[model samples]
Target: MATISSTWRVFLLIILSLCPITLSATVVEDLKNLHPPPHFNSTILSNCLKNPSLRYCSSSPMMDFDEIFKFTIVASHLCNESKNPTCVETFPNVDLKNRPNIAPLYLSFDFFWKYCPLSIMSIDLSNNSMKGGFPTDVLYCTQIQSLDLSINAFSGDLPIQSFSPLTNLTFLNLSYNFFSEIKLSDSQFFKRFNSSSFLHSGALLDEKKFTLKAVILLVGFPILVILVVVCWVWLCFQRPDFLPRKLQRTRRFTPAILKAATAGFSNNNLVGMSDVVHIYKGILRDGTEVKIEMYWDDIPRDSYRRFVEECKVLSRLHHKNLVRVLGWCRSRKFRAIITEWTEEENVEMWLSRSGPSWNHRLKVLKGVVECMRYLQEEWPEVNYELKTNTILLSDYMEPLISRFKVGDQTSNRKKIYRFGVFLLEMIQNKKGQEEFDRSYGEFIKYITTLDPADLHKMIDHRMEVTETNFHQVKQVLSLGFMCIDQSNNERPSLATIFNIIARAYKVSLVLPSTNHRIFHGERFKGHMPVQIK
Candidate 1:
């Protein structure tokens, strides 16, 4: 009886030894069954076992395999080409191909919560034809440092709080998505990104604040209307022409009149064609030469309103160096602006004649600076497209700067930077054509290191630089360089620039007072005296 009992104990020990192998095979079979039957791949189960932290890889008994199966399938789909034995160890990097209909295949947050609680660092899914709302699964990746989901078709409102878990996230790109709005209690995290990240997406707002604003606007709209009516009546009584002009109902011109003036919009009368408008040299009924600009018929209503608004502003602006606007015409399919015509060619064409003399170039430069100063300080609008080609020379060789487009109201700093580029182009005798080819910052870096002796190399060869005018030329170059300084704050103001140039030229022009206000209907304090040759 004792021998039989000992044999029974040995048999029990052998059964226990084989139990582990049976359990491992069962776990592997369960993992294989979790995936779709026809689509299930045996390689996925093999990959999961390779993970060092997985229960199947360790000596311990198996735990729940449901989440592990899901994770293995998804990771295998993402990284099928990976050959490393320990590729699934951490699942740190994931860059899946942009396959069609990938949304349904993507695993949900539950899978990530169970399997990938930590260890992910970076995810790049840019330009990956991905669709659906923001994946809540991403929020589970607490240790993730970088996330790129740009150029996707993700739609619906963003779950703003989902990003709160990613405390370690430093770089994020959510551009080119279909998000409707962004609401976040933590604005400090959002301040890390720039406008580019949010551009091409839906409007961004704090939902709580936006709701409050909408309520207020709805409640106070009647009171706002009453206030506007009262102000309109007061302005009407104060000035008779104010209401009519403000409402933009003062003038109307028939399309026939314009067609007659331009000989039925003949090709022979076409003076210039640009992206926005076509310029025609027309003769008015009074035998006055005028330049007419007409917009295409397909322009949007908003663009037409902008054109009219620009005309109103241009009518009020008067400067010696600026082109004068005479009148404007609008019809169902036509919009036009009339300005006094000049006979001389643009600076671009004139420069082709062996370039202008040093004196003429300096004169042109002075005129351009004066015009820029007027636009910057006196005018309410800013000119961003100031270039050498835009400056037209009159019959008397006076510079007339034209071609103004209304844009987002910017500061004078942008104008100053453009003027610096213009000056550089003038000195180089090259059309501003090369401005975009090379990096301007690199050019500035090279120019700043050059000595005064070598500065003449930048001057136009056509212009003779003698000992007499060397200092003046160098001074202008230095001023231009200063305007193009890397730091906008370090650049001199327009007034200071004018003074420097005037002093260098030994001109007797009157300088504006330091405290003078140019915008309050005050005339320009300084005017360039016409040189009498």
Candidate 2:
């Protein structure tokens, strides 16, 4: 009887082991629980769509496009349903019919560079869970005709070389990636309007045509609008103006002075921007270096006033971790803002280097947090436009936040909504503005109020899984999540954030997490900036 009972127990155990296990939720449900993450794969289209709020570390095969007629998920794997109605917006189905011989390719943002460098034709990486930059090496796939990389976490300038190689690319929509510009090197600039491929559609139009239309409007608009602006300017110059100016009088530069500083508007001074204004390196007579940036549009004129206001606010902010706005210049044909120049380089360029180590990332993060604390406390209505490029390493690897402009205090709730945006970029290891802004919007709506651990998932994956490192840093990321709550009432006050950071992270909490970290078995060596050592 005892033997029979033991045998029955064994049989029950076998039965239990053979039974299928049930899962309460999948990654999609997991993502939905947090700050509204980005709509990946168009949610309506690509199966590989990555979370806008998080930078998924790697990419994998998605479902076949033909499989969308059934459920979207296939065997717990991602598959594309090419026949879906929504795909018409990005890639016209015509490309699929024309390229019949081109077999389906798996283009992951991480591993695609190694396995499929350039042969991929008619591939769609759109709205998928891709992290990292536009695979410049994919440019080698000179045959790729239709490429849709929209709404993923691709950061940095899409290599001019990468796009330059795709002579056959008819449908190139990089929308929603953290790309700043489609630079026009003398060899590349597509003139055809049908190229339909771009960051913002406005960038793709013939500049000359757009300028003609803009001039026609400007020249066509009634002079009364100009008169009102002139009157507004006169009132601004007067000691007592109608609106109370929050500005404490400081040294201001005129437009001519700025032109002289920039060598008479030379193209040599044109820096770059992934989202904000372009920066130029300027040298004064005494040989002092001043960083100069011009807001792109000057014709509308109201933009100039807004820039002036932004500069005034920045001038008042005095912080070691924040860039110091020296002043701004307003000229009839030109406008410019001046600030402190750094030799340490922007985060993007540094990361592009052979050695922007994880140590550097951590060091930069500490400086960024310091700047954040200052902005939350010292600056009023501060907008944390935290991008990899905006976070500059000072001579000592201290991250200095550049480009402060004043925004409406009443709009702080909307502005703070960008905090989730910053967290999104950090998670994806993306370093551009567009992705930052989209994710910002996503978090404001969906992710900010979720339980903090859900928010923690947005931390950069490059960091190792250590208690004091990635884990605790994620706890701090939750604080960022708190600060960006849509309801200002729901947001954590700066004091509360400070107290929380103080408790969760030690004085030595920050450690770099850039590509420069060299792994040696279990240990990693940190690399300093070229300017440093």
Q: Rate the local accuracy (lDDT) of all candidates.
A: 0.61, 0.50
Worst 10 residues of 1 by lDDT: 524-533
Residue 358 of candidate 1: its Cα lDDT?
Answer: 57
- Residue-level lDDT tens digits of model 1 in 63-84: 4444544554444444332222
**CA lDDT for candidate 1:** 0.61
Clash pairs, candidate 1, are: none
For model 2, where is the 10-residue window of minimal lDDT? 70-79
Provide the lDDT at 145 for model 2.
77
Over 1-533, each residue of candidate 2 has an lDDT whose tens digit, in order, gives 33323322332233223223312344244223322114422442331232221112122374332222111121111212234233211222222222222212233222323223122356565655466666665454466677766556677665654466567777677665565444342334455324446545233345777689789788867676888788767645532213354542344765545556679767797666534466778775447688887765555668667777777877888877888778876656556678878874877666555344334454555556667767766775767566766777778767678755566453545444454445444443333223446454654455444443243233333444343344445555555556665444776654565465555444334444332323234332342211100
Please name the candidate that would achieve the greatest TM-score relative to the true structure. Answer: 1
Tell me the lDDT of candidate 2. 0.50
Give residue 361's error in model 1 in angstroms: 1.4
Root-mean-square deviation of every model: 29.8, 39.6
* Per-model TM against the reference: 0.45, 0.39
